[model samples]
Target: MPPCQSSQSFALDAIDSLVRCGVLITEENPEAAPVCDFWKKKGSLKWTTTDDPYHSDSDCEEQDLCSYKISQPSRCPDMLFFLCSMLAGHLRTLCWATMALDLMNTPLAEAEFVRQIHSHLWNTANQKKQYYESCSEEAAHTAVRTLIDLGVLLEERQTGGVFLGVSPLFQLSENRQKLHYFITQYLYS
Candidate 1:
């Protein structure tokens, strides 16, 4: 629900910013319009965009006319950070393992990532989907490579195909905590 509210705020902020920046402006205010109608009443000569060119803040007081404006959070945040923390190390580890086994560091577009993630799930479970004719070969290859690079799983290039090298780190019964420790140390360092 909070994320939904953020999305709504982002959308309205976007519209106001767009109109203010002259990226997208309405020629005439509609009856159902939410935009500031001062421009329609006055003229374009009276408006001035604020001083900052890089970031947008539309609180200019010099002009009576303006594009629609809204107060936006200076740096809008996403819910993913909270969600990721809730997952903690275990979830990141799981994702790392699965992604390594499928397609690590493979530059796939967002849609491709979703599709590859589903395929990775199937592969990890060793289950076959009815329609599973093929999977994202590139993503899978990339994941295996990532696993190797991250030392999560060792890899051996052999005849016919690649085989997993034994990973003493992951093989331990206390692998999760150990992995968390190592990952934190490495990432933080």
Candidate 2:
């Protein structure tokens, strides 16, 4: 039987191979245009350039990229957790309003849920004067769709109507606590 490799190790190996092939250029590669562009756009990838001059060129004053260190696996958060946290940050009002509804205990009709989010945003904007006008119904719909895409919310259809509730992923106590923390921190702080 083939050796069983953990997903993390497998992913790291694949990334290393890409890096070797110049497909996933690290900050260290001499030709790092793509990585530099990515850094400029996202500023998410960590990199550092050393002051030491390149051995091949004496006239060019560019710092050496070879010394840059790759980000360690231990320092990286789980992808799903990171995505959820980012989503909560981006949709703070929607996340807060949804959690306030306590969807786990009482699922709401889809329209009612969207209405609640719209109303919450309207009231919040009015109180904070954060916006000249209230958020539109389309924005509320998009937020709901995003939540569904992230598996944070689930949709169900009964004979009477379609209802929305917290997904099984968030129904777990641990996940629920983490999500609650993110939502509250983003919305209140």
Cα lDDT of model 2 by residue, 1-189, tens digit: 227875434544555564554343455456543321233233332233223344222244444444222332343535435554555434665554555445335478899888877777666667777642336667678767767654567899998699888775556655655655645553323
Question: How do the residues 1-189 of candidate 1 rate in per-residue lDDT, one tens digit apiece?
Answer: 356465434654556565565444444323532222223333332333333545333334454333432223335333334444554433433444443322434334433444555466446445533213223444445544555554545555555455564254444435534444444432210
Cα lDDT, all candidates? 0.42, 0.54
All candidates: TM-score: 0.28, 0.43
Q: Count of backbone clashes for each model?
A: 6, 0
CA RMSD of each candidate after superposition: 19.7, 16.3
Worst 10 residues of 1 by lDDT: 32-41
List where candidate 2 sits over 4 angstroms from the true fold: 1-90, 93-95, 103-105, 132-134, 172-177, 180-189
